[model samples]
Target chain A: MSKSVRKKPAAPKKPVAPRKPAAGKKPVAAKKAAAVKAAGMAKQPDIAPLLTVSDIHTYYGDSHVLQGVSLDVKPGECVALLGRNGAGKTTTLRSIVSLTPVRRGHVGFDGLDITHSPTHRIIREGIGYVPEDRGIFSSLSVREHLDIALWAAKKPPERRDEVLKIFPRISERLEHFGQQLSGGEQQMLSIARALLAEPRLLILDEPSEGLAPIIVDEVRDTLARVKKTGTSILLVEQNVAMALALADRVVVLSQGMVQFTGTPAELEAQPDVKDTYLGIA
Target chain B: MTFFLFNLLNGLQLSMLIFLMAIGLTVIFGLMDILNLAHGAFYMAGAYFGYVVFQATGSFWIALAIAPLLPLVLGFLLQYFVLQPLIDRGRSAHLDMALLTFGLLFFTIGLIDLVFFETLGLTFMSIDKPAGLGSYVNIGTFYPSYRLFIIAVGLLVALIVWLLLERTVVGAVVRAGVDDREMVRAMGVNVYVVFASVFALGCGLAGLAGVIAGAELSINITMGVQILIPTLVVVVLGGLGSVKGCFFGSLIVGMTETLSQAYVPALALFATYLILAAMLVFRPQGFFGRTPKSV
Candidate 1:
């Protein structure tokens, strides 16, 4: 693999030649592998992507954060977006949801062009987003949070019970205000709220960003269970190990561009790419 | 002792009027982050609408029923046409909204004066109290039935507003938007719709306050300007977005104004300012406002 050469050399020319072939060869092989995997995924059905973010360029004010990021999430698949700080990982998620509008490129969700759609319309179109800060309403109770999500999504009352089952801790804190809940509990509530929306695709921005090891494991386990239920996920994560554990495919972003896209095993094999881009040795 | 009780009752009546005026202003400010100076214009419009409607129908009840709607429709039109376009332009647009509303306030005042004083040759008009509320009620000492009615209306409106904010999904979205607007929008709420509806509701309530207050006080061109400052004081003392805070703040300012007028007539105007200044020194976010988180 030309992984080592591609990792180094900020100079464009040296990496381009070796990078193109490796990047080109891997995806063709992965797609064939994915198709084979899709055939096995017949029981799950709808192996086609629930979301496709193609060549998106997003900006924050004057700063061009995401230059041209592209990735997709197949139905029931958990795709991990790995990146260093300032690598535009969060921007990618925001752009897809149109929280931060994409300056250019297409965001296709459930067979609709949502590139220019309002944030609410995209959410109504069934892409639930859990922000980096958790976006909790400080004054509202946990139950209120769940109720609002249900109301916004126009989901059934029964969905609240279903979501509560995934994070039983949230049920315990139903009466507690958002500000009163601990960080782990807040994360659980945030995830639970998003789940209650019955979204076709869930875009989580660093769900494991600031959590205890035990809590992270619990979230990972909950997400694994969620995957079993056939909801596609586009997750941005800094915890490389936890991400690798959950992701069916890993898309590594470096300075707002897709540097690598393949399976967890493929990523693990490319240690040089991980070390250079992910700061993981 | 009787004089003291009378002033206290008067203060309570004033407080209710202030509550009616301030609630809408605070909500509009909180949800949209727009300071609408022309909110007073809606109050003025409501009074004028009441006058015209009463003249046409010869019924105070009919005037009360129809007057608030005029401002409500005007508010919706103003939001849809004038303010909504500027909302997305950022903080600079807020300044623009304030200036635009100030201009609207003057424009509306001029319009009212022209229609009533020049066209109709009616100035310094007063709406007669409804037949049911015309007499005095001996509550502790002799309170006007109409004053008592205004207080009842105020409490009822407060309860309704509280229910809307605390119990409904729309309230939840509005409250959440006050905390984090982008998050509310990302949750798939058409925040623009929420903004428009809330702005209209606030204006409608202001109009209701105007019609009710116009019956008690003389309806004139300067009535809106006279009450606008005190209403702003009520909003500031209460908190930017908290309805519960606005209620209590209005009571405090209202009591302060009337009580000071009774005890130290010279300080009535200055006392509210003194209290506000003191509050600012101690609690800048207002009585119920949360301390802003340093980002």
Candidate 2:
């Protein structure tokens, strides 16, 4: 089944094969770390994961999705979760925010175990999510979107100018409703709304979807600026090149499980992982 | 011309009353997606409660101020404690909830029949206009001051609702919630609180409309079911979940009913149904509702 390789939107800069695990899984090491933290409860070392999801099993009714999936994001590191549609990338993100209830396993955020908390409560603990649909409120104006995000978060509009500066075009369209904006502008508004919450971890689900090439570059640039500010990003993208370009580490999903975890060069190296899991030929 | 002006005022007065009832119905349907058949019960309860308050205090103003609170508290408890949990727990589908409200409607009428008629030995009752609004004002013809006051209250409420939905931060949250409930929650807003607030506010308005209507017309045991038809017609004609649609829909229905009944007494509601049918045929989404997407 030689299908066409899904081309990269961003130039494939450091393409590599997948890193094979000749090594043990992370549970034993994670257990050791958890035990140490519980014993000493010392201040986190620089390497302590900011968002740690360990062996999470989620289901939609009887249909099992996200089977025993686990991953982590360290401080200021961008981890891209890549997969084909139905690979449960979105569910993984939803699980992190507790939007989709996890049937099994643990999700540690910063230090607290937040696996069973409500979506709103999980979000209030500092997670910003921009969903796949862009999640724009068609009746609300751009300014209203920004204001409502802050209002919901119960935070002052302190990041308004600073975040809006990254999205200059959105600043100009403050009065326009979500339906009136073009696709690129809507995506820009979506990202800007998330950034205004002053989240330490910003999770975006395919912000590049449905945008023109030039607009994708614009988004990429804005995201690059956001990443430079030391905000960790957990991005899910069908746009493999775009995800790889920004990601310090990549997790590839195939049939609700992690197929590979490596640097972009490592993902580009293993053509078989890209071919089998990512549907790249 | 005087006769025509008379129908016009009557139409306008009816429109304002329907608007008051329809606004509450629209937001609750829009926010909660609960097709609450019991909404008209709130209007009926409002009139009864207003009558009780008026009897106790001998002040129309006091009745107007206090009557809506009972329905408000009742609606809040119904939604916050009962309806929402059923939906959230996945125990009741929307159809189930709608059926539950239909059951609630019957239950309320039974209680109203028992308390207001059988027990209290009340006949078809009406509240007198307050001293301030007792006299008629000359507007083309002699229009009753109280009717004019209903129109004023209706417009004032419309303005206030518009401001709350469009200008305030809470309104923005509501508008956003209407579009995407889950997204609003993901943004860290507890939408249940918002839903419960809108439910309380909507029921309160219905109660207020009932009290106002009681002053103008006779309030009877069957008033709840009688008003339910017009209110439902207005809600459907305007489109579910839109305040603007409710206002305009109310005007259209109110005017059509009053004018047609006055002139074409034989037609009854043939003309109003014609317009509603035409609306259903040409633009099924109503004035402000989005066109339903095909499955």
Clashing pairs in 2: A16-A265, A16-A266, A16-A267, A16-A268, A16-A269, A17-A266, A17-A268, A17-A269, A17-A270, A18-A270
Candidate 1 chain A has its poorest 10 consecutive residues by lDDT at A13-22
Q: Encode model 2's per-residue lDDT on A55-160: one tens digit a residue.
A: 7899999999988787777777788999999999999999989888899988987776788887888788788999988888888899999998888777777678
Q: What DockQ number belongs to candidate 2? A: 0.41
What would the per-residue lDDT of candidate 2 be over residues B48-129, giving only the tens digit for each residue? 9999999899999999999999999999988899998898777556689879988898898888889878888887999889
DockQ of each: 0.41, 0.41
Q: What value of lDDT does candidate 1 attain over all alpha carbons?
A: 0.81
Docking class of 1: acceptable
lDDT of 1 at A250: 82
Could you give candidate 1's per-residue lDDT for residues A49-110 as a string of tens digits? 56777778888888989987767777667889998999999989989988787888888876
lDDT of 2 at B276: 78
lDDT scores in order:
0.81, 0.82
Error of 1 at A1 (Å): 13
